[model samples]
Target: MKIKIPTHEDYQSHDGLHYYQLWNSIGDEWLCPACGRSKFQIMKWTQRFPNTPHSFMGWVAALHKHHDHSIGFFEPGQTRFPETLICGQCNSTDGVVKRMLNLPSNFSFSPQEMRTFIQATPHGKHKINYDQALEIFNLRATNKNGIPKVY
Candidate 1:
């Protein structure tokens, strides 16, 4: 099954700002347009089954169901697609900005580093899934902030 994700232009303009506002109102990373805080009232969506209605609906039925999900809280050109974070205060789109704040020490091993590590270790084997190299590189460990520090 193919899930349709909006294209880059679907969410952002040439200047890197959000062109749509609807996502900012409901998504977790969106700041409050009025309060400028990363908090908002959680809205629940009721899923309905198509044709033959039932409380526990099948995926196929859910897909065919016609449900109105629009809350009308935001306007067009108010949000950007592919954005993980939105500044609700000014309706500014900050995609991946928060994630790049810090790199944890564990991500230091690049793909080349992994290859070298595996080759140098005794009893090591080179494979796409380098379990042995991972141990030597310590790529699994991360900082408290969860940013990739070592890459």
Candidate 2:
């Protein structure tokens, strides 16, 4: 199934912000805009301060799902590119896969670092493996902030 691709005019009319608001406001369940799938997921990444491991990431994507349509709060000051909107099923395609091929390797967090992170926040107490932390960290690192770049 194909997703509705917004036109340039759509972006201009809203000054590039309305679409996100509209998507977030959908009350009833809607099909995935990318694959027409009924199932949708919410993804989130957090940036923690080294000193306290507190989420220094400010209010961000708080009102809406991640650009990927995953439901979760995103790091403040991070931007979501158009590529993020692609569903997981579609992400493996040749051209789309290449877009993420250049993503940097996950940041390595030492055991000590993990401990420090866990100690800083209430939610940190939950068991989170290194891979999981690394994935979120990477997403936080790569995400762009403000209006998504139109390509």
Candidate 3:
């Protein structure tokens, strides 16, 4: 299947297959279609947001490995780039809401998933308490679900 990737130009996801642009870019890292949104701002986390677990590690590595796209927040006062998602065009709170709902179905796996997937064997089972598990979903500056509900 020919999957369209993000370039310097903007492209939208058709059907169920949406390409998400990277929040940070590291020196010539391949840009896919998702990276070309109008709201795409090249921002980095101060200390890696809890939301991105595996990606945090990878992003750190990219910063060290590459000369460009060093992992740091976008400098204050610049043209607001694409990929923000909260902007007028592609305002998607669902993505943030889904971030909090980290079930296997939700795509945002909790720490439990890491423990279960990495520590547990196929025969072993790691049971998670739904109430306690939801605590992992708390997003800073946003609602508990992690999505910005009110503008």
Candidate 4:
């Protein structure tokens, strides 16, 4: 298959697949904010997201661009950057948590939230408790006005 990986300058001016592709293009030692897993770490997974079958080759080493779907948040002055780089498992778990919790379609867990939840709960392979995750999801923010949310 000839998948066209987007270059840093060739990506679109919006978010979504392109953002993740851009991150993959600029591959580095990015750590998943949730599990602290490295991009190059040799992990195993059969899927990246819902309904998506993932191969255990290059796909396992790919990092995902995790961000709040509703907020359009990112590093200040950066358009293509996501809030954080997360491993496929971590990012996939977020989707499972959101779906099971019935969170708003646009609701996305921030990196801090994912980190706390993963640490506090015994989650593996995307199995997490709704009530516990919900509580952490609503945790009070420490960021003050005029301060950008930093990981």
The candidate that achieves the highest TM-score relative to the unseen native structure: 4
lDDT of 2 at 56: 72
Q: Weakest 10 consecutive residues, lDDT, candidate 4?
A: 8-17
TM-score of each: 0.15, 0.20, 0.20, 0.52
lDDT of each: 0.27, 0.31, 0.26, 0.53
What TM-score should be assigned to candidate 1? 0.15
TM-score, structure 2 vs. true: 0.20
Residues 1-151, model 1: lDDT tens digits: 2333333443232222232334433444543322233322211122335455565521110001111121121223332122233222111111111123242321233222323432221111112334444443343344457544433
Q: How accurate is candidate 4 locally (lDDT)?
A: 0.53
- The candidate maximizing lDDT is 4
Order of the predicted models by TM-score, top scorer first: 4, 2, 3, 1
Task: Give one digit per residue, the lDDT tens place, for model 3 in 1-151.
Answer: 2323233333122111122233233223332122222222222112334566643421111111111111122232332233222211111222333444542222232222222222211111223334433443333214556674332
* lDDT at residue 130 of model 3 (Cα atoms): 42
Q: Sort all candidates by lDDT, best to worst.
A: 4, 2, 1, 3
Off by over 4 Å in 3: 1-107, 110-122, 140-151
**Residue 8 lDDT (model 3):** 35
Pitting candidate 1 against candidate 3, the one with the higher lDDT is 1
